[model samples]
Target: MYDVVIIGAGPHALSLLSRMLINTPDKYEERPDNKSLFFKNKSGVYKTKVKDNPQTRNTPRQLSTYLRKGGVIDENVLNNICVIDRHGGWMTQWSKQFDALGISHLRSTSSIHPDAFDLHTLVQFAEDHRREGELLEIDGGIRGSKFTGPFIVPSLGLFWDFCKSVVKRHKLEDFVTKGFVTRLLPKDGGYDVCLASGDVIVAKQVVVATGNIGVKRIPGWARDVYDGCVDGSLLHTWDIINNSDATGIHTSDVCKQMVKLNMRNPINNTGNTVVIVGGGLSSAHLVVKAAMSGADQIHLVCRSSIKVRQFDLELEWIGRSRFIKLADFYSMKSFEKRSHVVRSSRGGGSITPYVHQQLVKLQESGRLIIHEDTEVWECNKDENHWSIQLSNGHMVDCYIIWLATGSIVDVTMNPLFCDVIKELPINIIDDLPVLTDDLEWGCGSGLYVMGALGGLVLGPDALNLAGARGGASRIAHRLKC
Candidate 1:
């Protein structure tokens, strides 16, 4: 049995472990001048505001009960903690995912990191390593200066290396096991984390950071329509690039295979036109990647006009605009209001303006073609290529159809969560669980949640690094370490 079973090896899980291992000062509080952006929890905990509802299993005051007598783990809890992941190599899955997505840098600022003690731990690490020149200063207004500032975006290399450093410092890899958690059975004092490999782990407290976006979002049309086409070059952005088929094949051999296939079938050749469906940053990045990878025609089919901003959310949303508006939003009786606020703040997947600018350049140079406010009306695999029908009734034939649509957030998709909902009273809002201020799944339950599923308490940034830090702070504060 373990003291705490931190699930997933993502930034949130790493953040929680960092906080638990090291006693860090909650230094550099949110700026209060922008009342809209700053939200102080008052003292060390939130006040008990219980709503007298007979049907609800947990009253608001229940959170205060957990806070009053929160969790406790010795500094050596790292040894007692059991971390589970299918990949087994801490955050190698994330590294693979980011690389597969063709992303170069993080969308979040440098201030956000897994280090518990210092917000600028990453920046310090960069400078200490004498690689300060690699970090780029953000040009947008209200930039954060030097340490503990979002004014800088860490290169993917810096961010990845920092995470590895945290793992090495804590020796967390030794405690992590490789397996998929298929079921979470809550017992009297803890939970039985069952894996796909049939091993079960018992823990005093279980933190669910498995993330909501496990699978890629594939439209029904694509899968249903292309059921029997071996020549079809359809793929998701998350698909393993170096699949088992391409494992032993050298790059030259793989090219020869494609050449042979192209000679046998002209329609399967993706050396020219490639249609990328979706309007998110993933789609934008992939569009550019396709062009660079030698696809001369990069056709972007967007269902709606692209929403391009410098970051995920606008600057105003980061500050008073979000806090002030969300305060009024959270006070409402229903969870729908808070849900709407979270969704509307960063509604659709958006590309940064820098990407938008690049796409424009690509378009002007005739390397990229864009179809805004359009989607696949209907089409099937033809003899030559996949014939496409746009929502605007345009006809086109393409060699590749790439779907960069983001993942789905359905709770039912996760068997572990589905089992939890069956046994416990899980309040669902817009398909996400209504977590408490402590980020716990329910009242008095040892199971705490982080990542996108913690949207109820994390406001709008539940899925990003900011949300990861916020969730970790709450969990850390409620600890008796």
Candidate 2:
């Protein structure tokens, strides 16, 4: 069995692997029968640590010696740690996703390194790979399985060579790269991990570092709406990502096709109105994307006027610069008392300056309309189009409607843990895992959760990239037990 098995090849898994290797136990020649040298777990075992026996410590000591000789680490503790990207190619998927969207820049400034693994000490290890050759490099992507054995270190091939060169230049050889992890299950002693290809690995201690890739929470309302609109012309963001012919069309072309599909049929010039519902960043992006795609008239609808308040100084400045109207209905006195509650309950902010500038230009040209303090009461479809009723007593006649609503954590979407989570003895908070402070799910011992799935446990920041790093670090520290 392997010492650790991390699920999902995303950044979270990579970070955890790096931490595990860095904190791995080292053998010493001074002590022969020391079992309690490292930290103990709840069961009073000394966890996983190397012994200090002269004969047994030779290999580990030699490895450490080699590392020290190469200037990889000054001490043995640093040598034990290994950190590498779970994916053979670093940031390949993320970079592609961004490139497809024509997003040369990020909506938020993220603190991530080129490798995407975010541990300070582990990064240092990868920077010094030339001096220490102990770190093994694996290349095969993980396939799915339930079997577990000693951690299988796959061959790195050319990828390993590139990583080795990077480590040598950066002095980070202590970080080893093992390809993606596909599936994980608890075993008799520790855990069994299955790879994407069908390889089985057994480890004494396993860490499931699968990030949010496999988990998708389609909100209840969204699911209902998606089902209802399937026959009509409605498309979700997920659908767009999954169904689009990426190579065949540009981003604008995809958006235009989506808009056309949403319209259901050829729309008359006077009938081609679009309504986008939501108050979040995605909604704002949709507005601009739709406008760019040649929507004649666009209407943005939100439940409360708080949408305006969610804007930051930068966004507010953009709003002023663009002259976009702000709408809120609550009495000023009542708003003063409920502002804190509103901020806490209502999630997400509005448009960014970059988007706001574009939106303002559109509005100036009389292309966009904003409707605030309105809730969608009901939507009735006719043979020709849809008629939407708002709580504000206004009626919207449109050829297409786009629900840019947010997501919810639904375990049903994840086939791997669907049955397992259902059988576990734990409380599901807000339909999400009720994790402990360490981010471990209440039902499983070794299995931990991060990313959007842990939203109930981590609050608003749960799905963010930085949040994944924080959750991974917390889970790693707990595993040291």
Candidate 3:
């Protein structure tokens, strides 16, 4: 039995693991009465005698010490913890999404990353690698704040490299078990994590770090039309990006080159037409990527006018006044109000200025068309061509249709929590479980949740990198206690 079994190996999971490892108690002793074994419980202190030692603080010296130790890790933590993911690798899905969408840079700054040892670890890595050029500074005007920049926005390649270094430094690669968890059964104050491969791992504590484990939001008109279309012709951004072999495009700098090439030599007309639905960042990326790939008539269909912003939420949420904003969010006694704040803060899917600029350039060259205040009323597939009916009473013939509509995360409908809800009986508000301040499911249940599910507590940025850092730190601190 493992002390802790974490489901999912995304950036959020990585953050939690890194923090837990770095903060493990320096010394521990088996209880005298229970010397034969250390029984696991929600308290996490059934038979262990831990000294009142300050956790290894997040400092440069501590990080250096951890690195110098090389292959050595705290057995008190590593031996008892296990991480599981479908791909069995850190940030695999994240990289795939970026590659599929042809994203070259990240919207968030360097301050927000997976490493919990030191907040500035990524910036340090850039300096060490002499890859400072890869770190692009967000314009002061775009930042909407007085805060200046030192090229804090690290390129995709640089960020991935830094994450790889963190994984290697902590020797986390070998700790990951490749498996798809289908169900989590609570038994004897613990959980029997059942995987699709017919294997079960028992653990005292479970952390659900799966990002966006929600139902795909398919427009009502396209629901039935999707099944009738060719396998690859109709797909959601999630499906295309998550599937390994979905997109043939190579990852990384290829996307940057394509954008530049398409802008320089615009293709005014061609036989291919690709229609993209939605106006989020993914939609913007796909629009440019499709045009770059030589799709002459690329149409972007959005129900509302395009919203351009540097980040998903406003800059105030991540700026110097972030704490003040967070305090206001937490002051709310009602989850409904908190949820409203999250929705209002997000203000629906918006694209970054950089990607929006690319779309503008494509539109100017007459290769791309933005259909705002429009919706796909109906779609019919005929001989591999999609006749898309718009709300404006216009018909469009396209070879492929891409749905960039985001997902809807309803915890009540999530199958993983069906049994958990029955066993623990926690209050559910707007499909989000009312978790403890520590993000625990119920009173001493040992099961925890992160990501969007923790929105009530973590606020609007619960699904972003900033949320990863905050959520991971809170959970790690709870585990230590």
Candidate 4:
């Protein structure tokens, strides 16, 4: 039996793995006068190495080497850990989503990444690779917060390369098993992780790091119409990325619809119109893609006006104010109240200011239309096109209907945890489970959760890149303790 089994191999899993290694005591002894090579400036920011000691500059390189094959960590500790993913690869789903949606860069800052050893690891990697230009500054830096300086975001390509480097550096490939965990059966102070292929792995502890799977939220109309049918003309953004076949878009091939839409003739010379439903960043990306693909007109239908912001939430949650807010959040006894705060803080689907500006430019060019305060009242699909009626009394007949609607993170819907929950029932608020301060299930259960499902404790940024670091740190500390 393994000491620990991580359920998903996404960024969160990588973060947890890195953090666990950080917490694990090194096998090699260090100098007696060992001290931190890096130090913070008067402004309390941890920059590069101290200039006084030129030897200290190698500290970052030492830390980087720490994860290599012949690193300081004990081999037994690494051998005891097991990680599994459905795709059997690191960052498979995460990279797929980025490529499918054509996202240019990350929404979170550069410092917020999977590396748990140092916050500036990603920045340092960018500098090391001489791809500093890929680290674009966040439109507006955290102005009033102590987290000042250039709020940089890494390009998707750069981030992908960095993650690959992390996997290589950590030598994590040997620890990962390729399988889909179907069930988690807790017994005898441990759990049996059942995979889809009739294989089972027993572990003393389990970490459910699966990103938003089995939580696709569909609109009432779309559900009634499609009824789980894999229609080529209509597919959710998550569905397209996760299951490329659902929309006739093969993963290995460029989106077939783009070419088809560009070549298809317009109905009654009105041009090839496409309707995208939602106002989130994904929806905006789709709008821009369709517009660039020569779609005559694109309609963005939102139930409310588009909420534009630099990040998912205000800068406060990500800046130094998060500690105070988290303290207040933890103090509240009611899980329901905490849930309300999370929902309010997230608000709903929102687009970034940069993407919003792109949409506006497309609108001005008459290639895009924004329909705010409207919903898809009705939808009728034919062999040729889709006829949709908006709540605001506008009728749209388009060649394709893309749903950029966000997903729902319901822990109850997760099949792997169904048996575990039944065995040890825990308090759940609005589909989010109440975990211990260490993010573990109560009663000394070794099962732990990370990602959006852990929002009740991690706060609003629970699903973002930053949350990975926070969640991983908690779980790793608990395991080490």
Q: Output the number of the lDDT-best candidate.
A: 3
| Alpha carbon lDDT of each predicted model | 0.68, 0.46, 0.75, 0.75
Compose the digit string of candidate 2's lDDT tens values, residues 149-255.
11122112322343343344334444445554455565565555655667666654444444445333344444565576754345544444344454545333324
Q: After best superposition, candidate 2 residue 157: deviation in angstroms? A: 28
Best by TM-score: 4
Q: Clashing residue pairs, candidate 4? A: none
Please list all clashing residue pairs in model 3, or write none if there are none: none
**TM-score-sorted candidate list, best first:** 4, 3, 1, 2
- After TM-score superposition, the amount by which residue 275's alpha carbon in candidate 1 deviates from its true location, in angstroms, is 0.6
TM-score of model 3 relative to the true fold? 0.85
Model 1 clash pairs are 36-320, 37-319, 37-320
- lDDT tens readout by residue for model 1, 1-481: 8877877878888888877766534533222222323444645222222121112222334423322332343446566677887778677667766675567778777767776655656676777677677577765644322122235778899889878877766656566778888889977877899988888888888898886545678777787764554553666666533232445331112233334347334444445677889999988987877776556677899989988766676554453243444455445556788787778877787887667888999999998889999988876766556778888877767766778887877666777786688887788888888877788878778788888887766777887887777788777656432
Candidates in order, TM-scores: namely: 0.83, 0.58, 0.85, 0.87
lDDT per residue for candidate 4 within 215-287, as digits (tens), equals 6778898986656445456777776676666564642232356454453555544456788899789889888
Candidate 4's TM-score reads: 0.87
Question: Whole-model lDDT for model 3 versus the true structure?
Answer: 0.75
Off by over 4 Å in 1: 27-75, 141-150, 226-232, 240-271, 319-333, 479-481
